[model samples]
Target: MHDRFARSEWFRNDRFGLFMHWGAYAVPARGEWVRSYEHIGTDDYQQYVDAFRPDSFDADAWADAAARAGMKYAVLTAKHHDGFCLFDSELTDYSTMHNGFGVDVVAEFLRAFRARGIRVGLYYSLVDWHHPDFPVAGDPYHPDRDKPTAEGIDGHEPDFDRYLDYLHGQVRELCTNYGDLDLLWFDFSYGDLKGEAWRATELVRMVRELQPNVLIDNRLEGSGGEKGSIITAHPSEYAGDFASPEQVIPVRGLADETGEPIPWEACITLNNHWGYHAFDHDWKPAKLVVRTLVECVSKGGNLLLNVGPDARGRFPEKAVEILREVGDWLADNGESVYGAGAAELPKPEWGRYTERDGTIYAHVLEERVGPVALDEIDQESIASVRLVRDGAALGMAKAWMAEGNPGLALVPIGPDEAFSYPLPDPVDTVLAITRRSAPEG
Candidate 1:
């Protein structure tokens, strides 16, 4: 049941998924953390709720864009730290249904993604800024945390256990209503709010009962600072199914104390903001996006790349275009990226390498003006080598025994002069190396 037990093979094989950060905060177009960042009191923030109108939301387009980008699964922010539920929650009045959207957005997300044969996941936040029973006292993430609840215009005495009922009730609704969920990505638990505070054991048990096969994340470790580690407190019972790293990829594939690699996913954003912001234009290009995906595979991890749809519930055109280009790259070079894991070989100076079925995929990233060295790759083990970009084979003339190295192979570009390209391909060219023969004894 725990992480040490087993993992879904599909998760290991898929390796790429989409993360959508959308909610009522998107209406502000500031960012997902606008509530805390701006420190606006509850009454002021109600303006967004009153004005929430996303008439242009097209679920099919979102799912199609993700599928086209070679993403096998998607996770949406069913409810963010703001406590705005995108689904129709009967337990609470503060939801998309009350916003007059007259629709259950989560249901829409499920229908579209499921129709395209993509797995579904839901993101729920443990911190609720809008929930009354949830305390604002001493809560760093809360805008009114510093101020006394008695002084706030929209303030009330908070009860800890009452909030738990609401939290558990909402979670049960998500698990029971969603036909089949692949993942439940919880936002996090910070100081003073750890495992027992949320009654995680009972909550997780409920989730398992609802969807036996769905995988859970390790944020339940209650160690908010420990992002890349999913070690459960207990051994036999399952807590979270996987480790989740936010914003950046791990230096090395995340490993346990014993150096055994732990299953993890790098949840990164396409731009500076996770939610739609009309002003934040620091969008990462498509080339960087594809390269990041390859880097994840090489590091033996998955990439949960993010996209923030505007308040209209539509993905920005730039994000769509970037994902389309990434899809094109995956269409051609997926053999080197999908279903691949960390290679036994060390990282080449030129680029990274990923392995699949004993075959090596050398991702040539930089321009090799002279020669590329395969440091420890024995030449005899190479059955054949060809460029994935254009199935052109490379022979012994191109690769041969290195002069000084014992078992290395040097891929020479020219006899006396180096061959250069006017411009390197925007995307990395993968060199697929197949086994020629068994390694010599």
Candidate 2:
């Protein structure tokens, strides 16, 4: 069923997503850090802009990599401050279409992603430094502060209404042109003028009317808003269709150590830097990436890992290589992740478990020496127990029926081979174990 803006299945089942933070600003190679690094000076940053040319930018290639990585959706920055648009916008001359890149970035990405069966989401920042109608202390050519230039209805030389018209036109273009967008994630919502709420509401409403099932993020709300809220009010007052926890996944799963409701996602970058910084070679090992995903899903959260491409729009060689390694792991063990619920394992000196379809997938976090003990769960419910990693079958070594601690033990077959073998690295080792008769009441 549908939950307001997003499908419940999409919210729960999609355990992985790819987040792309790309814009004209990435041209500097120092990353989007140029916004603060150059200290809001347009003329100074323009040097990097003029030299920005992505000759090898290929949307299809990026989309293909994402698909191979097992990402269900990809979110791209439609426009990040510095006022440059990735899509063809009627509002500004500083866009990919007008720039040397002379291509509709969003349109091309949408086509590539859709062809690869990946859903598309756009990230649009609320602040625009280029617009003259945008309130500022200095010349309209550039705002001194990086914050959005508030709209002043009565006191601006350039028509403020025209700016809103431009915003609306571009938003309409985004929703309609993208063919059924999945998300319009807005950023920087704490500051918007009085009517901004209405404007945002109308914009999102218009988008929903067009797509009928599009989802909008909460930043569109004035101070307490989500996209469905009345014009620019903050959507916090309303429960968003889904909670988007950024940067960090809860240390434990969705619930804190004390069990509570918290749907979240961990948006971590492959390296220390988000955008490709030529000097930043540090990449999170595939093992770390896999472990992070396990921790997230164990807590009822999705892992929306981010990978910043170079200005040429190609996945950095480091990122691509690591992704392929992770993909191989996922290809072999995806069933334990996709369409699964937060793990509920008994106090195990050895492993953690993820459950789906009346089966408990034991992800061996630790390998015990002699025997594996499973307590509390009814033994009659366990149809067959096996070790999945190396195709070794586990035979029932012992079982005891006690009212308090009903127990079963599984022993490794070919103990000579198993004993000598090393356990899977720090990464969680997933072992698929089917239940006997589906846990009887």
Candidate 3:
């Protein structure tokens, strides 16, 4: 473990990451919540464990796919809420080492991804349904919630404190046994169990000691607990490096209590589910995927696009195809996105803006009326404008002047003039505008 670890420049500059949701749940070809949604008890759920043999699971292939898609980092589920461990943990018998796989998936993930120069993160669910010490009957997402299993029927009592010790021990193993990890993403916290209830302070201290730069997420809180505002140094009793907003991107990037900006990442699925769902063919198109990445960067946030590997431990063909197309788009227009953040200007009606060093990438996602209106910027300040992909300098002029308007780029409304300045295709085609050196006040 590298004690000098912390969220470094790599995370902030990369702006995009890959999230993988895999476990025994993928064996069912259902979503990650297969057990809880179906209310299947431990005995019935063990069928997946018995059948779990991912002969086609190639960590290198997975890493290559991520690198192709221009993902700089990736996070894999080391253990899900179902409590199946992908790693060979000495403390747990129910791990990939003993389960049918008989392989350390986490080790493979680290070795393969690192080979491609991609940083790795591990996702560990705090709520373990399989652990006997975990309150199976009381926890809402537990498979045996409100129902008695063999242990409950035999008059066994659940000791949550013991579970905490096990959880902390497993975390220690993750931090120590493996090499430096970029992130230790905890799944969630909810209800009264939020925050300090998990003895997060002690756990965080231990993690920092093990790997000083390991970035922890907000979910260390109990189920349904708050992931607090990133504006504050310590959102709760525990301090984390960033905010994790799942499913939906924030309307605007988060701001702290005092109105300072907060670093955040939007974790979204490529389709309807996070884990393999055989019938979840309702996938998002590559166009939308690329735009979403640009959108996150535009809002001063990161996008963690997810991929749910199938039962054979390979990405579905559809997902692979989508990623390939996205890779192509990124290859051409990556300059506008990588290392860029919110331009701090008003949201453009046409699309969005991402700022980096001395340039602004104007992403046109929608068709806005007439010449591009750079809402608040002065027309005189733009030194040059070039189509991001084609590399052609576009001519500009002060087309209209209004009460509060300094000026907007002028373009002819006629058909023939359209040929002079053509729009970039693929929806999120970006225009790289170089700002002139600002005049001294």
Candidate 4:
């Protein structure tokens, strides 16, 4: 049997990526779901589209920021739920080509990120409120679902099959027009709009044919909250390649019925909102971002962090600063993150444990009073212990404090087996533990 997660090899290794949510919604300076949240009519929302002019947009700058943030991949919102196309879609006149500064945003993004060796992906929202054939009244997330006629949409009999054709056609355009995509992130499936309601199987088949190696998220069969059959013994045809958990990380990561690890990623925003909100100053600190990334890596999952660019196509200054700080930290301790997964040992009391190639990375998030106990690790198996940031050798000894527990293996943080209060790297002081090789037969 083919490995269901074979295509996710790169994704697993990457472990960190950038997710950009930019479109006409950026013009409003509100979140991406502003229309649905505030019940804004199509006519009122069209004004932002008319005013959308990202003249200061520089794709290279965006790519540079991601690279500096140590992100190995990126995904841009080609067509968000608002149905505004960032790419040059021949099928639609309501795109950047017709509305915004006439630049093919998706194409530029792909080129810039690809140039920087960042694997590029596009986020296509399955829910398009602008499309006439798409159901409005009685639909779950539509702005005018309660009163379709009230939202500047002329009341008419909607043909969902026609909408599916358009959706499929646009997906095809994305697959064909883009040279080689590494991922295709679908927005969602909620209420009764999931599975065949969007002709998901057919759409997935077409995508697979066009981009065989592209990693697809589970949204085709599930949403952010629902993981779908991807975590089951037998997944559906449209089960997708990876579980996409949004906003929150999985408590224990994801696994199949057989206990095999399932490929998963946590899509988290740098701030509270996905789209650029001028007043949303609630940005996550660089320390939290770094620790969050380490947590994801330790759980055998990737972290696709988001940055919502403002209307002028510039990433918020604070976002850039935070990313730079994260990059600075990654520079010294990237070995503990990239290609690292959950260690065979249990979670350490100090922090988490990630392993790669028999080397255990003890991410010391807290400072312990005595020699940090390397629980569940045998003293004979330990070859060497060193700090990941500076490669300073840390002494391993059975400190007198742990005399009561002779079986415990401890690594002292200070001279004479004394424990230090403040760790060298306060955010995450990673200790690299190399396991001794087995005797030759």
Which candidate number maximizes lDDT?
4
lDDT of each: 0.81, 0.65, 0.80, 0.89
lDDT of 4: 0.89
Residue-by-residue lDDT tens digits, candidate 1, 298-392: 98889999999998888998999999999998888888877899998888888889999988998877877655666568776667877676677
For each candidate in turn, the TM-score is 0.93, 0.82, 0.92, 0.97
How many angstroms is residue 239 displaced in model 3 relative to the true structure, after the best TM-score fit?
Answer: 3.2
Q: In terms of TM-score, how similar is model 3 to the real structure?
A: 0.92
lDDT of 2 by residue, 1-441 (tens): 222333446656768778887776666777665665555555566665665568888999889888888788888888875677888877677887876768888899999999988888887766566656655544332335443433331234556566677777777888777788876766545444433543755665677678666555555543222223322223333333454555566655543223444445566888877666777778899888877777677667677788888887788888888888787778777877787766566535665566776677777666566445564455565667666656566655544323245455454433542353455544666666777664458
| Root-mean-square deviation (CA) per prediction | 2.6, 5.1, 3.3, 1.5
**Which scores better on TM-score, 1 or 2?**
1
Worst window of 10 by summed lDDT in candidate 1: 415-424
**lDDT of model number 1:** 0.81
Full candidate order by TM-score, most accurate first: 4, 1, 3, 2
User: Which segments of candidate 1 are over 4 A away from where they belong?
Assistant: 1-5, 150-155, 222-229, 232-238, 398-401, 412-424, 437-441
lDDT of candidate 1 at residue 419, scale 0 to 100: 50
